[model samples]
Target chain A: MKTLVYVAHDNVHLGDATLATVTAASKLGEVHLLVAGAGCGAVAEAASRIAGIGKVHVADDAACEHQLAENIAPLIAGLMTDHDAVLFPATTTGKNIAPRVAALLDVMQISDILSVEGERTFTRPIYAGNAIATVESSDAKLVITVRGTAFDKAEAEGGAAEIAAVASTDDAGKSSFVSAELAKSERPELTSAKIIVSGGRALKDSATFENIVMPLADKLGAGVGASRAAVDAGYVPNDYQVGQTGKIVAPEVYIAIGISGAIQHLAGMKDSKTIIAINKDEDAPIFQVADIGLVADLYQAVPELTAAL
Target chain B: MKALVPVKRVIDYNVKPRVKADGSGVDLANVKMSMNPFDEIAVEEAVRLKEAGQIDEIVVVSIGPAKAQETLRAALAMGADSALLIETEEAIEPLAVAKMLKAVSGEVEPGLIILGKQAIDDDSNQTGQMLAGLMNLPQGTFASKVELEGDHVRVTREVDGGLETVRLSTPAIITTDLRLNEPRYASLPNIMKAKKKPLEIKTPADYGVDIAPRLKTLNVSEPPVRQAGVKVADVDELIARLKAMGVA
Candidate 1:
């Protein structure tokens, strides 16, 4: 099978999701990388060096800038005719573009696939990770989005694949990028963070969430995450959300602070090497998966724990 | 302008889904079902628009088994003007759902269609975008905020890194994210009022669309269990354990 993997990029560097997507796409067939953005030649060059990629296709145009799904979806669908399967990293961009392409191809999309069972089969989490469903698609052309945490990231520089430029497709002109407000942080990316400290709705307000959670994260040099409850309560940005609907992460050590672990939150972080819970409520479902469970008020314990560290 | 909102009936978010012993699928038998949480947000957003006088009417639609009428009624109680049920028992795929909705939209010609980003049951997150593609309409997905202008809708979307704003033409698709709005609970009085509202029932065959499953489920199983470790009495003990494990 011939496969095309969409590389998530920001016009300069490829996101970590791209390498993991390559790792997943490699399981299906020979993988080719597609990089679409404005002035993204370096991104395409970086993608070509990924270990498993056979070729890199670049569609560098102003219309491809910001990866507005309206323009990018049609471009990807047009390229689908040459590949038997198309795989994307189940990131925000992937989730946005894959479905549009799938609809264009009139095929069903298999999303957040955890494992590849066969050429046409995959296992995905449903009911927010409570159960796993193995799905086999009969579509001639498969459109899939893979959970990056489920696969090892492909090495950055092992192979030298040829890069080719593809003509830019027509813009849909129905939607355009207005602006973006990205969270600027020195901490590691959540999905790739070795250690993550996550807070929940108990944080109360954004100021408290930052003050209480940032100290612990600083001590461990960990990325900060939040349950959807915390995010919905305006305690943190949506990007900080860690859950079934949010970013899926599997860090080395995951510490849940003041979080009543909803199944959705656990779906993202349950694969952590070692889980720790610091919720005041001992009965919180988070403790079920936690290696070390501490039943103490986060308001007092977090400060004490940070000082002790 | 009319708004079309798609609501799905799924196992309630509060209830833990259990896999059947035979590994065929999740056991929905006797489980409490509710309109998908995200769909509730969609319904709430549409109702808010109507209350604000921006939308003339709110049309809620669901495609599911007979019991899905309850989900539609919930939407009606939440302020949707009417309901439509595309009756089917098959585990319909996203493309087929999109096609069916596309057919329905042809008759309704709604100014906007709002849907949840995904259903908790399948977590496909495809139908709204698929419908937009099939109908050749612009989509604002994972929208945290939506504002309708004269001819277009400005949507603030939840992206990977942070928030992104996009402007799409009218007759667009908007998929609700968690932060969109807090869905209001249906009061007993509104529930009674919803019972008297019109709910038209149709089948997939009525729309000349086949709601078939494109993917076959081979098995359903539980995820690997994480064993409970030693409970630490205090911060000192927790640090000691972490140090002993070389994970600190």
Candidate 2:
């Protein structure tokens, strides 16, 4: 199978999710990458170095600067002539664009596959990861979004592949870029972090959450995360939320502070290698999945833990 | 300008689904169903837009079995002017659903369309973007906040990183995220009034769309359960355990 993986990037640096996606694509067969953005030659160059990629196709044009679905879908669909399957990283951008391509190609999309069972068969979580469904596609062409944490990241530096330029398609003139407010943080991104320290509504407000969570996260070189209750209570930004509706992370260690593990929250982080929970309530659901449970008030324990670390 | 909101009746968010012993799919024989949480937000946003004078009419639609009319009536009670139900018993994929909605859009000619990002049942976040692709319309997906300008709409999107604002011309598509708005409950009087609202029932055949499943579910099963581990007496023991596991 010839699979085309959409390279997630910011026109300069390739996204970490793309490397994992390439690994997922490599499992099927030959993997080719599509780098669609304005002046993204560096991204194409980075994609070519990923271990098993066969080719890097660059669509350098102004229309794709924002990676808008209106401009990127047609470009990917047109490139589907030679590829049997098109894979995306299942990031926000991938989720936004892949559906348009699937619709344009008139195929059903298998989203956030956990494993590739057969050439056309895969398993995906439904009902917020409560049930797993194995599905097979009979379509002539396949469109899929891969969950990044389910696969290991491909080696960043290794083989050299040929980079070729593809003709850019015209803009659909439907949507236009206005502005973006991305959080600027020095901490490792939550999805790729080695360790994550997440807080819940028990922190009370934003100031207390930042004071309590950030100190421990900073000391441990961990990414800061929050439960949906924290985000809904205005204790943290939405991007900091780690749950079924938020970012899914399976890091080396995940420490839940005062989070009464809702099923949705557990869905995102239960796959972590080491799970630790620190909550006052001994009967919190978080203890069910926690590898190490510490029944304590977070106010006293978190500060002590940070000092010890 | 008229607004269209598409809602889906799915296993309620509060209900835990159980896989069938026969491996057919999640058991829904006697499961409680409600409007998909995000679609309820979509309906709420449309009602707010109508109340704000930015929208002249609100038309809600659902593509499901006959019972979906209850979901449509719920939307009607929430301030939608009318409703449409594309009745079908067979399971329809997102691509087919988008195609049917495309035909509905042709007849409705809505200036704005709002839909849930994904249904909790299938969890396939595709229909809105697919419908936008099929109709060649602008799309602002995962919108947290939406405001109308003179001829364009400004939408604040909830992305993986943070918030992004985009401006799109009229006759566009917007999919609601979790933070869009808190949905309103249908009051007693409004529920009674909704019984008299217009609701038209159609089929995929009526719109020349094929409601076929392209993907086949080979089996359905439960995910592996995570085992609970040891409890630590204090932070020191937790640190020691983490260190022993080489994760601290």
Candidate 3:
């Protein structure tokens, strides 16, 4: 089986999600990496060096910049003619594009696959990770999105695969990139962060959310996250939300500050290696899953913890 | 203009699904069922559009067992003009659902199609995109904010890094994200009115689509459980333990 893996990126560097997707794709057969972006030669070069990849297919064009799904989906669909299976990283970009590709090919897409049972069989979590379903597809072609946390990141440097260019396709003019307001942060990305420090609704406001959570996160060099309640309260952007409906993170160390840990919030980070909860509520649901639970006022404990660290 | 919205009936989000002892699937025999949370958002968005007079009609469609009619009625109570139930017992896949929606879209010629980004039960997140592809329509997915302009729609999407705004022409597809809107509960009066709303029941064959189970379930099992560890006395001890565990 020949598999084409869509490398999720930002036209600069390949994210850890791509490496994990490559690892999942390798389970199928020979893997080829597809990088779609403008002036992304370095990303393609990086992709070619990943172990187990047979080739790196680059589609460098202005239209592909920012990976407008309208443009990238067609470029991917046109290339799917040669590959038996297509895999994506299950990031926002992948989720946005893979379905369009499946629609174009008249195929069903298997998403957030947790385990690959066979060439066409996969296990995926449903109901926000509460239930797991094993499905086998008989579609002639397979389009899949792999959850990054489920697989280990493939070695970044090893093999040297040949780099080739994929032809540019016509832009549908259906959708165009208006603008983006990305968070500028020095800490690691949430999904790939080694440590995450998240706040809940108890943070009160955005200023407090930053004043309390960001300091600890910065002290530990951890990614910052918020509970759905915090995000809904306008404490942070939606991207910072870590829950069943938001981004799922499984960092090595996860600290929940002032979080009551609803089941939805737990679903996203319960797999962390070491879970710590700092909340005034002694019986917060978060403590049940927390490896180290601390019952205290987050206002005092968080600052003290940050200062000590 | 007409807005077509697809709602899925699934186990309520609050229910923790239990895998059957036989390993066939999640136990849904007596589970509390409701419209998928994301689909509820989609229905709410469409209803808001209709109320805003941006769209003249809002059509809600569901594909499932006879019980799916309840899901459609719920949408109607929320102000959808009518309901379509593609009744089926066979487990339907995303591709088949997209095909059926495409057929419905062709017949309805809706100005816009709204759907949940994914159904919580399957969590495939593919139907809206697949439907967009089948109909050769533009798609704005994972939308948190949707605004209709004269001839196009502007959507704000919650992406990995932050938010991204996109503009798409009319006759587009927009999938609902979590922050799309707070769905309103159906009042008793609206529920009564929904009982009189038009509901057309059809099958996949009526739309020339096959509702076959494309995927086979090998087994259903739970994820590896994480054991509860020792609780620290204070923040100092918590840090000490984390350091000892080499996690911090």
Candidate 4:
């Protein structure tokens, strides 16, 4: 099977999610990466080095700098003439663009697939990960978005693939970028972080949450996350949320502090390799999935743990 | 200007879905159904826009079973002027739903279309984007904040790294995210008033859209349960356990 994998990038650096997506696409057959952005030759060069890639198609155009769906979807659809399946990393950008391509291709899209069971069958989480459904598509062409955490990351370097330039498409003139207010953090990104230290509403306010959670995360060199309750309570930005409605993470270790894990919260991080929960309440549901449970007041234990570490 | 909001009735977010023993799909028998939480935010945003006088009329739509009128009425209680229900007993995918909404849009010709990012049941975040694609309209998806300025709408979108703002002309699409707004409950008086609101029911055939299943579900099952591990006595033991596990 021939596949087209849209490279997840920000017009400068390649996103780690694309590595996992490349791994997922490799499961089907040869993987051809598509890098579409203004002056994104470096991203294309980086993608060509991924071990299993067959080729990298670069669409360097000003119209795609922001990766707007209006321009990118049509570009992808036009390239689908030679490919049987197209895979996108299920990021906000991918989710916004893939469905449009599917509509342009006159096919249905399978969103956030957890596994590629066969050429046309895959498993995905539904009802906030409560149920898993294995679905098969009868469409002649397939459009899919791969959940990054579900698959192992492909090797970043090792192989050399040909980089080809494709003609750029015209601007759709429907939407225009105004500004961006991305959160600037010194720590790693949540999805790609090896270790994550997440707090909940028990942290009280934003100041206290930052004071308590940041030091531990800094000490461990880990990414910071928060439960939806904490995010809703205005303790942190919405980007820090780690739950079913938020970001799904599967890190080497996940530390839950004062978090009474709701089902939605657990759905995001239950796949972590090791989970440690420190909540004063012994009956908190987070303990049900935690690998190591510590029943203690986070106010005291967290400080002590941070200092000790 | 008129605003169009599409909502879905699904199992209440508070309830856990149960997969049938036969592995066909989720068991919805005797399940408590409510407007999808994200769609509630959409309806709330539309009502707030109308109250602010930016919108003259708000028309809500739902493509589901006959019972979906209840969902539409709930939107009406939240201050929609009227509602349209594309009634169907068959399971309609997002692509078909987008097609039917496209047909409805041809008649409504609303200035703005608002939708929930994804329904919690199917968790397929596709319909709104697909609708925008089919109609060749600009889209501001996963919007946290929306503001109207003359003929253009500015939206603050929730993206992977952080927030992005974009400007789209009138007759655009906006999908609500979790942080958009807190939805208000329908009061008794408004619920009574909603009963008198105009509701029109149509079928997929009226739209000339085929609601066929492009994807077939082979089986549905629960995810593997994570086994609970032992509790540590203190922070030192927890640290030691982590060290032993090679993850500290």
Candidate 5:
């Protein structure tokens, strides 16, 4: 099988660049890495070192700068004819782009791939993430969205192949590039954060919100987060949101404060390693998923917890 | 302007989902079903737009079993002019749902299509974007505020970054994030009015949509159990532990 991996410098590059190599070595295939833009020469170089990659394909164009879906989707569909299977790192960009590419191919698209059980199989979450489901798509030309964080990145090894120019569109130019604001934080991103601190609507007012959420995050050196209600209430920014409508976070320790643990919010943080919930309501939905539950006011508990840590 | 909203029957948000002993899936035999929470928000947003005179009408749709009409009523009660159910027992993927709606969008020629970011049960947040892709329209996902500007729509949304505002041409797709709006309870009068409202039932085959399972599910399993950790005796102990772990 020839596996073509579509990678972006911002979202797809990881410590080991494993998505480029994992199925590459595991399954006998020709691996082609599509470094979507420039400055990811490092990522392409990393892909070449992986044992299974047959060639490194760089779709370099000034329009490829941001990998806007319109330009990349058609290009990937065009690339679909060359490969038996296509994989993309299951980032936000991956979630949107892979399926469209598959739809164009009239094939199956598997999302949030945990592991490849076989050449045409994977495990993913379902039902607001209360359970993990193993899935298989036997379609000839398969498109898969791989959770990049799940696989071990391969160490850099070999020579990088020459760059190739694939036809890309100015569709990104057609669509308005509205203002973009990245959530600036020294802490790791919620999706990839090892430790996460989440506050529920119990924070009461926006004035108490940062005090309730930020201190706990600071104490634990964790990324700060909020339940959908808290985010919706404008107590916290959307980037800090952890839930079904927001981010799916799988971290080592996820400390949820004042959160009611709605099913939607649980779906996002349920995959955490160490789950702790601090809420005034003992019966809050979050308690069901937490390893530790403290039925107390988050206001009193959070400050003391922060000071203690 | 016109609006399109999608509602799905899901296990009530408050119910605790049980993993079946066979691990086939969660049992929904006797579970109370309700309109998916986010879809209710979509309906609420559309209804609000109508009340504000921004949108002239709303057409709500659902793609599920026959019982889905019950879910559709919840939308009608919220002030949708009419409802459509593309009945199917087969669990439909988001992409196929999008394709069906793309056809519906052409028929109705709605100015905007509103949807829940994902149905809580299936939890696939793909349909809105796929519909936009299939229809070749601009999409403003997880919208917080959807405003009308003459012939175009200005959608304010919470992106992976901070809030972003996008201006798109007519026929845009806007998905509801939780914070979009608080759904209003259907009043007793409105509930009575909903029964008299029209509901058009169609089949997936009628829509020329083959609702096939693109990704086949093999098994369902519990995530690895997390071991309990002791509470630190003091701040100093917590600091020491952090230092030992190099997290400090």
Candidate 6:
């Protein structure tokens, strides 16, 4: 079966970079891609290296940037003929675009997928990632947004495939971008990061937030995060916020500082492999799930830890 | 000015979802269901904006089945002015839901539209943005703080990277993040009033919408189980154990 995975590039010719482990999913049939028109050549060359991938389709177009629903949704719907199924990295962009595309194709969408068990059955999160639910797509064509971290990266092999130019669909009337404000980040993207360090409102002040958390994160080569409480308290920016309503993170080492773990808050980071809590309140809820609980004031402990590192 | 707060009926977030023996879906036969926790936050914010005298009236609207009326009533009990239920027997796709909201928005003439960032059941999180797109209005998505000033609503929105403050003109849409507020419970008097308050039920047919579902479900299954690890007695031991797993 021919499968297409969308990659983040100017267009879709780029290869699938899977750094994580693969289970039965790694064995899916010939993998192909539909990337942006701008870098279609480069993307196609890269896709050739993915061990299981056979063909590459470049839907290269300037309009493809940002992967807006109007243009990409119809484009994906048209491409359904060439493949048995389609896959997307379960990022925010994928979440918005995938289902809309599925709708346009009149097909079912299995999203935020953690695993693929069969030709039609998929496992996904339920109740905000607290539990997993297995879903089956009865439709002939399956479209899914797979959680990128959960899958093993397709190994690269040097064999290029010809890039097929799928006809473009004009979405001039769909929607126009008034403006977008993408938060500037100096660290690795949150979902893809290996380590994450988060804080909460107990830090008391916004100015003190960066001072108390950033340095420690810098030392550990970790992404910085804040509990929804801290963001709502206006102590940090939303991009730094991690929780049920924010982002679900599963880093190798997750350090929670001054956070009182609400179920919503825990929903985001509880999936992390190693959990460490640093809070003055020994009774803080975060300590309950923490692999390491430090009973010390964040104001004092943060600076000390930064200096020690 | 009229303000519209969209409510979502989802599995009570506090309760864990269990799969049925048949693998059909979550075993919700008797599981607790409530207004999506985030919708409660949206309702609370709109109510506060109304109570603080910044907004005139609040309407809670749900785009679901007859059962969704329960969610709308819950919003009314929390101090909304009225309730609207877009009764669609079939599951309403986000795009279609956005389209219906735009049509209703034209009639209600709301200065602000407040809804949860994502519904817990599907977690699509697209309706708000799609609605804004169809209406050609600005949006404050994942807002943590919002204020009404002059002709603009200065909102602090949660972006993937950080917070952004946008000054959207009066008729803009805002989706509430979970931490937007710790929702207030319905008071006794308001609950009593909500029972008597008028609830306008308009089917999608009434709105002249077809309400066709765009996406279909193939199958729903459970995620892989992570083994619960043993608890450690001390920090040193914990670190040592984590290091052994190469997870520290």
Candidate lDDT scores, in order, read: 0.91, 0.94, 0.89, 0.94, 0.74, 0.71
lDDT of 2 by residue, A148-195 (tens): 999999999997999999988998787899999999999999999999
Q: Can you list the residue pairs that collide in candidate 5?
A: A16-A153, A18-A153, A49-A157, A49-A158, A261-A286
DockQ for every model, please. 0.80, 0.87, 0.74, 0.88, 0.40, 0.24
CA-based DockQ, model 3:
0.74
Q: Candidate 6: misplaced stretches above 4 Å?
A: A10-28, A37-49, A156-159, A280-283, A299-302, B1-6, B14-33, B40-67, B76-115, B122-159, B162-197, B200-248
For model 1, what TM-score is found for chain B?
0.96
Residue runs of model 4 more than 4 Å from their true location after superposition: none
Q: In model 2 chain B, which range of ten residues has the least summed lDDT?
A: B239-248
Better of 4 and 6 by TM-score: 4
Instruction: Tell me how far the alpha carbon of residue B240 in candidate 5 is from the true structure, in angstroms, after superposition.
Output: 5.6
Q: Give the least accurate 10-residue stretch of model 2 chain A, judged by summed lDDT.
A: A167-176
Evaluated at residue B150, the lDDT of candidate 3 is 89
lDDT of each residue in A144-236, candidate 4, tens digit only: 999999999999999799999998789999899999999999999999999999999999999999889999999999999999999999999
Q: Write the per-residue lDDT of candidate 5 for residues B159-234, one digit (tens) a residue.
A: 6656666677777788887777889999999999999999999998887877777777778877554444444444
Q: Each prediction's TM-score against the native? A: 0.97, 0.99, 0.97, 0.99, 0.86, 0.75
Model 6 C-alpha lDDT per residue in residues A1-309, reported as the tens digit of each score: 667776654344342333221122344566676664444666656765556555666666666654555567768778888887777776555555665566555455666776777777767776676556655655677777776656655556645566677766764343333345766778766776889888898888788888788887887778888887898788876677787667778888888888988867887887788787877777777777787777777787668666655
lDDT of 1 by residue, A1-309 (tens): 999999988999988998888888888999999999999988988988898679899999999998887888888888888999999999988998899999999899999999988899999988888899998998999999999989898999888999999887878889988999999999999988999999999999999998999999998899999998998888888899998888899998999999998888888899998999998888888889898999998898899888887
Tens-digit per-residue lDDT, A1-309, candidate 5: 877887645533633334533553345366777777645555666656665456767666665655556567778778778888877765556665666676667665777666778877777776766677888785778777766545555545554555555655556433444566667888877766788888888888788987778877877778888898887788977788887667777788888888887877877777677687777776676777776667776677678767766
Top of the candidates by DockQ: 4
Off by over 4 Å in 5: A9-30, A37-56, A60-66, A153-161, A172-174, A212-221, A252-263, A273-309, B231-248
Candidate 4 vs. true structure, TM-score: 0.99
Q: Candidate 1's fnat? A: 0.86
Decreasing DockQ order of the candidates: 4, 2, 1, 3, 5, 6
Q: What would the per-residue lDDT of candidate 3 be over residues A25-82, giving only the tens digit for each residue?
A: 8899999989999999999999999987898999998889978778888888888899
Q: Pick the candidate with the highest lDDT.
A: 4
